[model samples]
Every structure is written in structure tokens, then in C-alpha cells.
Target: MSSSPFPDTDLAGNDARVGDGRNLDSILRIPVLMQVVLGSATMPVADLMKLGRGAVVPLDHRVGEPVDVMVNGRVIARGEIVIVEEDNSRFGVSLTEVVGPSAADQNT
Candidate 1:
């Protein structure tokens, strides 16, 4: 019989087996890049080059529209921008919807 390298018990001494008894802790620690896309715009190179400080570029989405939350360039969820009450000067994303496996795969 072969022995597995991952510990069978979690830190609390409870069986840590995930679906089919696979330990997920180690893989959970792996980092992935996350991005919140507010919107996007397209413009001619000449117009793009004219962008300067205080210049506004119109985006496809309107205000209050849900923004896509991407992981490694794939959309995984959607959220809305919210002001962080803890720090009024900053903003945060409040997840509104979690993409299901089918939707996530389609986005990719």
C-alpha cells in the first residue's frame, strides 16, 4: 500500500478529507490572480494617444451595472462597487452573484 504525503487529520485533529478523501488545504493555499473589471472602452489610436490627466473615456457599462470578477483572465463572478465604510476613502466590491461551473466555463 502507498502512503499519501498530506496529513489525514486537520489542525483540529478532525478528518480533513474533502470530496473523495482528497486533502484540499495544500491546493487551497496556491494563489491565483484576481481582477475586478469595471468596464472597457475602444478608441482610435490617435484618440487614445490624446488621453491626458482628467480626460474621461466612455465605457460600455452604465453606472450601477454589475462588474465582472475575473480569476486568471476568466470571469468567475459578478459584483457591484461599494464604498468601504471602515475606510471611507477606499472602495470595495460586494459580490452579487457567484458563477456556476457552466457559466464560468463559458466565460473562459
Candidate 2:
């Protein structure tokens, strides 16, 4: 196997492998909440309370705009909404951009 710049290591600085040895199977099994945010809007409490059936609240995003794909409340990527080919009744997100977390992202 080719040498790696950063070999996988566990908490104790041991190799993280699956050669019937130590691994991170449990860690990988942990679940995280994923959300697709189309857009958001801000309104006063009075206006929000006034909202009823058939009322439309406009969002900041326009049609064909990329939606934010969030994981555990963090924006991880941006993608456009798509219709599932196998199931026309379902909707999916086609990831276009993979966001790398940075200091500036903290505010997002």
C-alpha cells in the first residue's frame, strides 16, 4: 500500500484499521441530523401570529436557487433540489458544492 501523509490513528495514537484489529466502527455508526434548507424569512411576532391557511410567506431565495444542506445545524454543502428519477413522487438534493468549514462559516 502507498504511504499516507496522515495515517489514521485512534485516541491512543494506534492504527485505525479493520485487519481484524482496532477500528472506528462504533464512531462511524453515530447518527447526525441532516437538513435541507430552501430559505428563510423573518417576520414580527404579530405578523407571524396573523398567518393562517392559504397565507404565503415569501422566502429570501428565489426559484432554481441552491439550497443549504446542513448537518447538525452546520451548513455542510449547497445543492439544488431535484426529483428522484426512480421515484417521481420524491424529491432529492443534487449536491453541487461541498463547503469546507472555516472561521468565516462560524457565523453562518
What is the alpha-carbon lDDT for the whole of candidate 1?
A: 0.87
User: TM-score, each model?
Assistant: 0.72, 0.75
Displacement of residue 39 (Cα, Å) in model 1 is 0.3
Candidate number of the best lDDT: 2
Tens digit per residue, CA lDDT, model 1, 75-98: 889999999999999998999999
- Model 2, total clashes: 0
Clashing pairs in 1: none
Q: Per model, how many backbone clashes are there?
A: 0, 0
Q: Against the correct fold, how does model 1 do in TM-score?
A: 0.72
Model 2: which ten-residue window has the lowest total lDDT?
18-27
